[model samples]
Target chain A: MDGFIFSLIIGIFIGGVCGYLGTLMLSRKMALTAGPLGHLTLPGIALSLIYGFDVSLGAFPFVILGIFLIWLFETRTKLPMETLTAVVFASGVAIAFLFLPVEQAETALIGNITRVDIYGTIITSILCFLIFLIIRKNYHKMVLINISEDLAKASGINVRKNNLLYLFLIGILVSLGVRMVGGLLTAALFAIPAASSRNFSKNLFQYTNLSIFFGILSSLLGILIYKFTNLPAGPLIISVSSLIFLISVIFKR
Target chain B: MGKLKKQVLKMFAKDKKIILKVKNLTVKLDKEEIIKNLSFEVKEGQVLTILGPNGAGKTVLLKTLLGILPYNGKIEWKINVKIGYVPQRVPFVKQIPISVREFFLLKTTKEEAEKILDKIGFEKRILEKRLGDLSSGQFQRILVAWALVKNPNILLFDEPMTGIDVKGKETIYSLLLKLKKERNLTILLVTHDLNIVFKISDYVICLNKYCMCRGPPIKNVTPKTLQKLYGSKIKFYAHK
Candidate 1:
C-alpha cells in the first residue's frame, strides 16, 4: 500500500481502539490516567533500546506492568488515580532519558506514522475489531461494572476479572498506538474523539459508531495534510479532530 | 441469637414466596456497628418497608444485602432472581445529557423500556427529552422505570421517593402497588415515608441497631414499638 493509504488505515485502527478505551476512561472518570499510560511508553521504547528488541514488543510488557502498578497504587494509596498516572508518566520520561540517545528520544517524542509496516497496521486493525466485539457483547455487564462495583458483584459480573481484562486491552492499545503515533500525542487519539462523540450520542451503540467515524475521519484528514504539507502526522490528526470537536460544540445548542 | 430462617422466596427462587432470610446478621462500617444481629424474611406478593430514623443504618443494611458492603452474618435468599436495584442517589452531571429512554435502555430492551414509561403515564415525548432538563420528580420516575425494566422478581429500593414531590410519590406508590399485584414481586423498600409504607406494605420491619419490630403492619406497629426502635425522643404517628 502507498504511504498515505497505509497511514490512514493504521490511523483508523489506532483511533478506533483509542476511542473505545477512551469511553471507559471517561465513564470511570479516569481520563487523566491516559496521560501517564501514553507518556510511560517512553521507558518501554527506551528499554527496547537497552535490551535489543522490537520497541513495540518490549514496550508492551512495561505498559502492562505500568497498568498493574497504577492499579496497585491507585487502590492501596490515598492519592487520586490521576496523580498516580502523572507520577508514573513523569518517571517514565526520566527513565527513558537516562537510557536512550537524544536523537532516538526526539524521534520517539514526535512520532512518525509512516514508519509503521502494513503487516503491523493489519494486525492492529484485527485486534481492535476483536476488542470492540468483546465489549459490544458484554455491554450490559460493562455498564453495570462501571456504575457500582458492589452492584456488579451482586449481579455476577466478576468485577475484578472484567476490570483486569479491560485494563489489559487498554494497555495493548496504548502500546500499539504509541508505536505508530508517538507517545506525546497518542492519548489525544483516545480522548478527543470519544469526548466529542459522547456529546453527540446518548446510547452506547450510537456513541461507538460516531466515535469510530470521527476517529477515522480525523486520521484520514491528518494523513492527507501530512502527505501534502510535510507536517507531523500525530499533531495534524489531533488538530483536525479538535477542530471537529470545536465545530460540534459551537452548533450543539 | 435468632434462629436461621429459611423461608420461601418469591418468583426468583425455586421455592417461591420468600424474599430474604437473615441469621445473626451484623454489619460494621469503619468499625462502627450498623446492623446488629438482625433477621427477617419477605414473602411473595408483599412489600416489606424498612423503617428507621436518620443514621439508623437502614441504608447500610440495604447496601450490605446488595453485596456493596461487607457484613458478618448468614443471609439465605434466592440467588436466581434478577434483582433490580435503585440507589439513594444518581450522580447528575450537567455536561452529560442522557434522555429518559436512553437511561432505561442501558439495562433493558427498547420495547420493555417504552412499556415502562407508558405504564408510568408519561407522554411518549418524554423519551426523547434530555435527562438534564428533567424536573426532580421526572428524574426519580425515570429511575423507577429503569429499575422496573429489569422485571425483577425481587426489587430493592433505597429511598426511591426522595427528591420527588407529593404527587410524584403518590403516583410511584400507586404504580408500585399495581406492579406488586400483577407480578407478585417481593419488594424490600427503605423509606422514611412511613404513611405510604403503612398503607401499602404487607409487612414492616422497624430497625434501630437491630430488628426491633417486624410483623404485619398496624396490627403489630405501635408508638411504644417506635420508641423502642428509635428511642423515646422519636415517635411514630398512626397512618390516617
Candidate 2:
C-alpha cells in the first residue's frame, strides 16, 4: 500500500478505538482527563526519541502510572475526577518537560504517519480488537460503576477492582492513541465523536455505534486532507471531528 | 469478639429469615471515624428505617453494610440473599443518551426489566423514554424498578427521597408498601425524615454517629431519642 493509503487505514483504526474509549470517558464525565494525559506523554516520547524506541512503547509506563495515581487519589480523597485529573496532569507535564528536549517537542506534538509500518499497524489492529472485546463484555459492569459505586457494590459487583481496571484500559488507549493524534490533540479523538453521537442517539447502543462511525470517518477524511494539503494530520483530524460535532448539535437543536 | 460472633452466626445458621446482622460495626474515612460502634439486625419481610440528622453517618453506615466501605465489624448475611440498592442520587451527567430500557439492560435482561417496571407502576411506554426526560417521581420509580430488575430479596435505600417533594414521597412510600406486601421483601432505608419513620417503618434506628435507639417505633421511639438524634425540641406524631 502507498504511504497515503497506509496512513489512512491506520488512522481509522486508531480513531475508532479512541472513539470507543471516549464514550466511556464522556459518559463517566472524565473526558477532560484525556487532554492532560495526552500531554503527559511528552516525557515518554522524549525518552523513546532519545533511546531510538517506538514512541508508544516509550510512553506506555508513564500513562499507566498517571492513571494509577488518579484512581488512587479519587478513591482515597473522594474528590471528583475532574479535580484529580488537573492535579495529576499538571504534575505529569512538569516532570515530562524535565526529560523532553525542546527541539523535538513540535515533532512529538504533531504525529507523523510516516512513522507507522505494517508491523505497527498489525499490532495496533490486534490490540484495538482485543480492547473492543474486553470493553464489550464488561460494558454493563462499567456502566454500573459509572452510575454509582454504591449501587454496583450492593449488587455484589467488585466496585474497586473493576474501577481500577477501567482506568488501566483507558491508559492503554492513551498510549496507543497519542502516537496518531499527537499528544496535544489525542484527547479530542476520544471526546469529539462521543460528543457528536450524544446529540444524535436515542439510546446507549446507538450512541456507541454512531461514535465509532464518526471516529472512522473523521480519521480517514483527516488523513486524506492532510495528504493532499501537506498539513499536520493531527489537527486536520480534530477539525473534521469538530465539524461533525457541530453538525450533530444542529441536528439535535 | 469477632470469633464469637462468627460462631454465633454459625449457630444461627439455619434461621433463614434473619436476612442481615451487623455486630459492632465501625467505619473510618480519611483517618476520621465516620461510623462508630454500631449493631443492628434486620429480619425478612420487615421495614427498617435508619433515622438521623445530616452528617449522622447514615450513608456511611449503609455503605459499610453493603461492603462499599471497609469496616471493622461482622456483617453476617443469610446465604444467597441477593441485595438491590437505590441511591438518593446517581451520576448520569444528564446528557448521556440512554433510555430507561437501555439502562435496565445494563444489569438484567429485557424481559426482567419489563416485569420490574410494570411492578413499579410504570407502563410499557416509559421504557423507551430517555432517563433525562423523566419527572422526579417517575425517575424515583425507575430507580426502584432498576433495583427490582436485580431480583433482590432485600433493598437498601440511601436517602431515597432526597429531592422528592412531600407529594412525591407519599407516592413512593405507597409503592414501597405495596411491593413489601406483594413480594415479602426486606427493606433497610436511611432517611432524615421523622414523619416517614412514624408512618412506614416497622423498626426505627435513631442514629447519630452510631445507633442511638433501635426497636419497634411505637415502643422504643420517644421524645428523648428524637432530641438525641436531631438535638432540637420536636413534637411527636405517629401515623394513625
Candidate 3:
C-alpha cells in the first residue's frame, strides 16, 4: 500500500510537469518535435544500463544532443516535421533494441516505471516544473513570435533569443517526461490534457491551467486504477486524459 | 547673390530626423533575388506607400524592411524607435480564446489597449468579445489598434486593406491620415490599391523587383506611367 501510494504521488508530479511542457508545445504547434525527444531517450537509458550510471543522467545529455541535431536537421532540410519525427523515433527504438542486451531490452522498451525510485521522481518533477515556469511567464512574448515572427521582431521582441530559450526548455521537459511516463506514452501526457482543454479555455493562460488540472487528476486516478486493478498505469492515465479531452470537445463553447 | 543663396539654402533644408533608410538592399529566396538593390528613405511624419502587383515582391520588401526575412543590406536607422506592424491577416489556428482587450494588451496594459481601440472606433463591449467572433473588417481595425497602442514612431503595414470591405478600407485610409496628423508618425503602407494609395500617400513608389518610379503624386504621371512601370497589361483608374 505504501509503495503504491508513493508511486501515485510521483506519477501525479510527473503528469503535471508533462502537462506544462505539452502546453508550451501545443501553443508553439511543435507536436512533431515531441516524438523524437521522447524516443531519443532510449539509447541513453541503454547506455546507462551498460555503464551502471543512473539512466536519467545518461538520458539527459543525449536528449539535449538530439535536440541540437533536430534543430540542425530542420535548418538543413525543408522536410516536414512529421517525417523527421518518424525517422528519429524509428532510429531510437531500433538502437535501444539492438544495444540494451536482450534480457533488459523488454523492460526498457515498455519503460520500467514501477522501478523508478523516489529520488528519480523528485528530480523529474523539479525539472519539469522549472521548464513550465520559464515558458509560462514568457508566454505572451512567445505567442507574439509564434503568431508572426516579422510582427514580433518589428515590435522589439527578440525572435532568436526566444526561440533558443524555448528549444532549451523543451529539451529539459522532454527528458524528464520520458523518464516518468516512458518514451512512447510520455507524448500522450504532454499532449492529451492540453489538447482537450484547448476548446474550453479562452486564452493561453487558462488553457494551460486547465491542462495541468486535468493532467494531475488523470495521473492520480490512473495510478489508483492500476493499483486496484491489474491495468497498465500509462494507458489508464492516457485514457482518463483522452476522456476529459472528449468531454471538452462535446461541450465546447 | 548672398540673399539668393540664403533663400536657396532655406528651400533645400531637409528634416534631420530619419525615420527609416534602406540602402543597397537585396533579398533572396531559393537563389532568386526578390529585392534587387532597392534604396529609399522615409522622413518623419511622411507616408510612403509601396504599390506593386501580387508577385512583384511588394510584401517581400515590407518583410525585409521589418527585418523579418534574411537579406543583404545596410539599414542605416531603425533602432530604439517603437514600431507597429499590421500583417495582412492573423490566421486562426488553435482557437486560443482571447478577448479583444486581452489581445491588444499582449504587449501593453488593458487601459492603454482600450484607449487605442477607442481611437480606432471600437466600442468598450468589443473589448470583451472573443477575437475569433469579430468580422474581418473589425479584426483588421483591431490589428491597427494593436499597432497604435504601441505609440510607435514608425508604422509598417503589409496590405492592411487587402481583404477588407470597402468601408473597412475607407476607415483604414482615414485612420492613416488621422494617425499622421495626430501622432506625427512616419508610415510605410504596402498596398495594391493604387487609387487609394494616391489618395492617402505623400509619395508613391511603383515597384517591380526594383524601384521603377518614385515621386510626389502628380496628374502628369497618369495611367500611362503606371502602365509603363507595371507592364502594358496593368490597368489604372483615375480617382476624383
Candidate 4:
C-alpha cells in the first residue's frame, strides 16, 4: 500500500475504536481524562524519538504506569481519577521536556502518520480490533457501575477489577492515539467525536454509532487534507472533529 | 407428650433458617465510625426495615451489608444467595443518554426486562424513553424493575422513596409489598417513613450510629424508642 493509504487505514481503525471507547468515558464524565492521559504519554514519545522506535511502542509503558498510579490512588483516596491524572501527567510532561530532542519536538508534539509502515499498520489494525471486542463486552457493565457502584456490585459485577481493566484499556488506547494525533492532541482523537455524537443521540446505541461514524469521518478527512496541504495529520484530525462538534451543538435536538 | 411437642416447635423455628447474620459490624470512614457495634440477623423471606434520621448511617449500614463499604465484622450470607439492590440516588442517570430499555438490558435479557416492567405496571412504550427523561416516580419504578429482573432471593433498597411524591410513595410501598409476597423475597430496606414500617416490614431496626431497637415492628417500635432513635426533634404520632 502507498504511504498515505497505510496511514489512512491505521487512522480509520484507531478512530473507530477510540470513538467507541470514548462513548463510555464521556458517559462516565471522564471525557477530559483523555487530555491529561494524552500528556502522560510525553515521556514515552520523547524516548521513541531518541531511540528510533515506534512512538506508540515507546508511549505504552509510561501511560500504563500513569494509569496504574491513578487507578491505585482513586481506590485508596477520596480524590477523583481526573485530579490524580492531572498530577501524574504534569510530572510526565516535565520529565519528557528534559530528554526530548529539541529538533524533533514537533514530531512528538504532533504525530507523523505518514511515517507508519505496512507492518505497523497491520499490527495496529489487529490491536484496534482486539481492543474494540474487549471493550464491547464490558461496555454495559462499566456503564452500570458508573450509574451506581452498589447496584453493580449487587448485580455480581466486580467493580474494582472492571475499573482497573478499563483504566488499562484507556492507557493502551492513549498510547496508540499518541502515534496518530501526537501526545498533545490524543485526547481529541477520542473525546471530540464522542462529545459531538452525544448532542443529537437519543440513546446510547445511537450515541456510540454516531461517535464511531464521526471518528472515521474525521480521520479520513484529516488524512486527505494532510495529503493535499502537507499539514500535520494530528491537528487536522482534531480540527475536523472540533468542526463536527460545533455543528452538532448547533443542530442539537 | 409435652416434651415431644416442645422439641417439634424448636425444630420448626430452626427450619426458618437465618439467611443473613451480621455480628458486631463496625464501619469507619476516615477513622470516624459510621456504624459502630451493630449486630443483626435476617431470616429467609422476611422484610427488615432500617429506620433512622439523617446522618444516622442507615445508608452506610446497607452499603456495608452489600459489602460495598469496608466494615470490620462478620457479615455472613447463606451460600448461593443472590442479592439485588436499588440505591437511594442515581444522580448520574439524568445526564446519560441511556434509554430505559438499554438500562434494563444491561444485566437482563429483553424478555426478562419486558416482563419485569409489565409486572411493575409500566407500559411497554415507556422502555423507549430516555432514563434521564423519566419523572422521579418513573425512575424509581425503573430502579425497582432493574433490581427484580435478576430474580435475586434478597433485595436491598436504600431510601427508595427519597425523591418520590406522596402518591408515588404509596405506589412504591405497595409495589414493594406486592413483589415481596409474589417472589417470597427477603428485603433489607432503609427508610424514614414510620407509618408504613408497621404495615410492610416483618422486622424493624431503629438505628442512630448503633442499633437502638430491633424486633417485630408492632412489639418493638414504640414512641419511646422513636424518641431515643431520632432525638426529641421528631414528634411521634401513631398512625391508625
Candidate 5:
C-alpha cells in the first residue's frame, strides 16, 4: 500500500510537469525533441547505475547538455530542430549501448516508479509545482514569443532569453520525469495531455490547465492500475494518456 | 548668401525633433549584404514609407531599425521613446488554440485589449474569437491593435497589409493616417505597393540594397526615382 501510494504521488508530479512543459514545446512544434531527449538520458542512467548514484540526478546533466546542443544548433546553424534532435538521438543511443549493462537496459528503458524514495518524490513534486507556477505567470509572455520573435523584441521582451530559460526549464522537467516514465515513454506524458486539451481549449488558460489536469489524471490512474495488475507503470500511463488523446480527437470539440 | 543658406536649411529640415535616425546602416545575413550603407531620418509626426519591390531589403531595414536584427552603423531614437511593431502576419498554427483576447493580454489587460480592439475598429466579440479563425483583414487589424495598446511614440510596420484586400488596405492606411494626425505618431511603414505609395506616404525612401532617393512623396517620388530603385520603367499615377 505504501509503495503504491508513493508511486502514485511521484507519477502525478512527473506527469503534470511534463504536460505543462509540453504546451510550450508543442507550441513551437517540438514534440519530436522531447522524446529523443528522453532517450538521450540513457548513458547518464547507465553511468548512475554503474556508480550506484541517483539515476535521475545523474541523467540531469546529459539531458541539459542535449538541450544545449539543440539550442546551439538552432541559433548558430539554423538547422531545423528535428534534424538536431535526430543527431542527438543517434549519438545518445550509441553512447548508452556502450555503457549500459544489457540486464539493466529493460528496467532503464521501461522505468520502475517503485525505485523512487520519499525524499526523491518530495523534491520532484516541489520542483514540479515550482515550474507550474512560473509557467502560469509567464504564460502570455511565452505565447507572445511563440507568436513572433520580432514582435516580442519590440515589446521589450527578451525573446532569446525567454527561449533559453524555457529550454533550460524543459531540461530540468524532462530529467525529473525520466525515472518514472523511463526514457522511451516519458515523451508521451509531455505530449499526449497537451495534444488532447488543444482540441477543446477556448484560450491559453484552458489549454494549459486542462493539460495539467489530464496529465495528473493519467499518472494517478495508471499507477492505480499498475498496483492491481503488475504491468509496467510507464507504458500503462502513456497508453491511458494516448487513449484520452484519441477520444479527444474523435469527439473534437 | 545668408538668405539662400537659410532657404536651403528650411528645405532640408524634416521636423523640429528627429524621432529616428539611421546612419550608414548595413545588415549582412550570412554572406549577402541585405542592406548597404543606408541612411535616413524620420521626424516626430511624419509617415516614412520604405518603398521597394520583392527582395529589395525593405523588411531588412525595418528589422535593423527596430534593433531586432544586427547591423552596422548607428540607430538613434530620441530619449524616452517607445516603439511598437506590426509584422506582415503572425503564423496562426492550427494545433495550439489562442484567442485574440489572450494574445492581446500578453501585453495588456483584458479591458485595455477590448478598448484597443474597439479603437482599431474590431468588434468586441472578436476578443473571444480564436486567432487562427480570423480572416486575413481581421488578423491584420488585430496586429495593429496589438501594437496600438502599447501607445508607442513610434510604430514600425513590415508589409502590414499583405494578403489584406484593397478595401482592407485602404482602411488600415486611413487608420494609420488618423493615428499620425490624432496622436502625432511617427510611423515607419514598409511596402511594395507602389499603387498606394502616393496615397499613404508623407515621405518616401526608395531602396534597392541602398537608398535610391528619399524625401517628401510629392517631390522625391518621381519616375526617375522609381526607375532607379526598380531598374525599370514603372508608371505610378498619383491617386488621392
Candidate 6:
C-alpha cells in the first residue's frame, strides 16, 4: 500500500478504538486522564527516535511502566488515578526533553503518520481490533464499577483486577496513539470524538457506536486534509474532532 | 416443658440457620476507626436493619460486609451466597448517558431485566429513558430492580430512600417486604427511618461507631438506646 493508504488505514483503526474506549473513560469521569498519559509516552517516543525503531514500539515500555506505577500507587496510597498519572507524566516529559534530538523532535512531538509501512499498518490494525474486543467484553463491568464499587463487587466482578486491566489497556492505547497523534495530542484522539458523541446519544449503545463513527470520520477527514494542505496529521485530526465537538454542542437538545 | 417454653425452643431451632456471621469487624479508613469491633449475625430470610444517624458508619459497615473495604474481623457468609447491593447514591448517575435498559443489562440479560421490571410494576417504556432523566424515586426503584434481576439470596441496601418522598418511601418499603416474601430473600438495610426499623426489620442494630443495641426492634430498641446511638434526644413513635 502507498504511504497515504497505510496512514489512513492505521489512523482509522486507532481513532475508532480510542473513541470507543473514550466513552467508558468519559462515563467514569476520567476523560482528561488520557492527556497526562499521552504525555507519559514521550520518553519512549524520544528513545524510538534515537534508536531508529518504530515509535509505537519505543512508546510501549514507558507507558506500561507509567501505568503500572500509577496503578500501584493508586491501590497502595489510596490516591486518585489522575493524580498519580499527573505526577508520573510530568516526570516522563521532563526526562524525554533531556535526550530528544532537536532534529527529530518535531516528528516525535506531532507524529508523522506517513512514515509507517504496510507491516506497521497491519500490526496496528490487529492491535486495535484486539483492544476493541477486550474493552467491549468488560464495558458493562467497568460501568458498574463506576456506578458503585460495592454493587460491582456484590455482582461477583473483581473490581481490583478489572481496574488493573483497564489501566493496562490505557497504557496500550497511549503507546499506539502516540504513533498517530504524537505524544501531545494522543488524548484528543480519545476525548474529542467521545465528547461529541455524548451530545447526540441518548443511551450507552448509541454513545459508544457514535463515538467510533466520529472517531473514524475525523481521522479519515484529517488525513485527507493533510494530503492536500501539508499540515501535520496529528493537529489536523484533533482539529477536525474539535470541530465536530463544537457542532455537537450547538446542535445539542 | 410449658407451652410458651416449647414455642421458644421451636423458634430457636428455626433461627439456627445463620446465613451471615460477623465477629469483631473493625474498619479503619485513613487510620481513623469507622466501625470499631462490631459483631452481628443474620439469619436466613430475615430483614436486618442497620440504624444510626449521619456519620455513624452504617455505610462503612455495609461496605465491609460486602468485602469492599479492609476490615479486621471475620465476615463469613453461607457458602454459595449471592448478594445484591444497592448503594445509597450513585452521585454520577445524573452525568452518565446510560439508559435504564443498559443499566439493567449490566448485571443480567434483557429478558431477566424485563421480567424484574415487570414484577416491580414499572412501565416498559421507562426502559428507554436515560438514567439521568429519571426522578430520584424512579431511580431508586430501578436500583432495586437491578438488584433483583440477579436473583440474589441476600440484598444489601444503603440508605435506599435518600432522596425519596414520603409516599415513595412507603412504596419502596412495601416493595421490599413483598420481594422478601416472594423470593425468600435476606435483606441487610441501613437506614435512618425509625418507623421502617420497627415495622419491617426482624432484627435491628442501632449502631454509632459500635453496635449499641441489637435484637428484635420491638423488644430491644428502647428510647434510651436511640438517644445513645444518636447522641441526642429522640422522639420515639412505635410503628405497629
Per-prediction fnat = 0.19, 0.83, 0.53, 0.74, 0.77, 0.74
Chain A TM-score from candidate 3: 0.89
Which CAPRI tier for candidate 4?
medium
Q: List TM-score (chain A only) for every prediction.
A: 0.92, 0.93, 0.89, 0.96, 0.96, 0.95
lDDT of 5 by residue, A1-253 (tens): 4677788888888888788888887888876677778889989988887888787887899998888777777889888777887888888888998979998897678788888778887888888889888877777788788887778887878887787788778888878877888888767878899999898687788888889999999989888888899899888898889989988899777
DockQ of each: 0.32, 0.67, 0.48, 0.68, 0.62, 0.65
Q: B67-169 in candidate 3: lDDT tens per residue?
A: 7788998765544567778887566423456677667767889889878777878789998787778877878878888887758888888898877888887
Ranking according to DockQ, highest score first = 4, 2, 6, 5, 3, 1
| Residue B236, candidate 4: C-alpha displacement in angstroms | 2.0
Q: Candidate 1 at residue B221, lDDT?
A: 74
**lDDT for each residue of candidate 6 in B1-240, tens digit (9 for 90 to 100):** 778657545654666677788889889998999989898889889999999989989999988888888889888777567888889978777656899999988867888988899999897899999999998888899999988876888999999889799989988989998988898899999999887887789999988898888899998888888888888889987666
The models' CA-based lDDT, in order, is: 0.76, 0.83, 0.75, 0.87, 0.82, 0.87
Local error of candidate 1 at residue A23 (angstroms) = 2.4
Candidate 1 local lDDT, B1-240, one digit each (tens):
223323333333464556567788899887899889998776776789999888988988888887778989887666555777777875533334456666666666778888888887788889887776788778777766777766788888889788888888888888788878888877888998877678788888888887788888787677777777767755567775
**Candidate 6 TM-score, C-alpha based:** 0.92
Clashing pairs in 1: B8-B18, B9-B17, B9-B18
Tens-digit lDDT string for candidate 2 (B29-105) = 98899888888888999999998888989888878877778989788877667888888788673667788988888
What lDDT tens digits, residue by residue, belong to model 6 across residues A111-145? Answer: 88998998999999999999999999999899888
Question: How many angstroms is the interface RMSD of candidate 6?
Answer: 1.2
Query: Rank by TM-score, descending?
Result: 5, 4, 2, 6, 3, 1
Among all candidates shown, the one with the greatest DockQ:
4
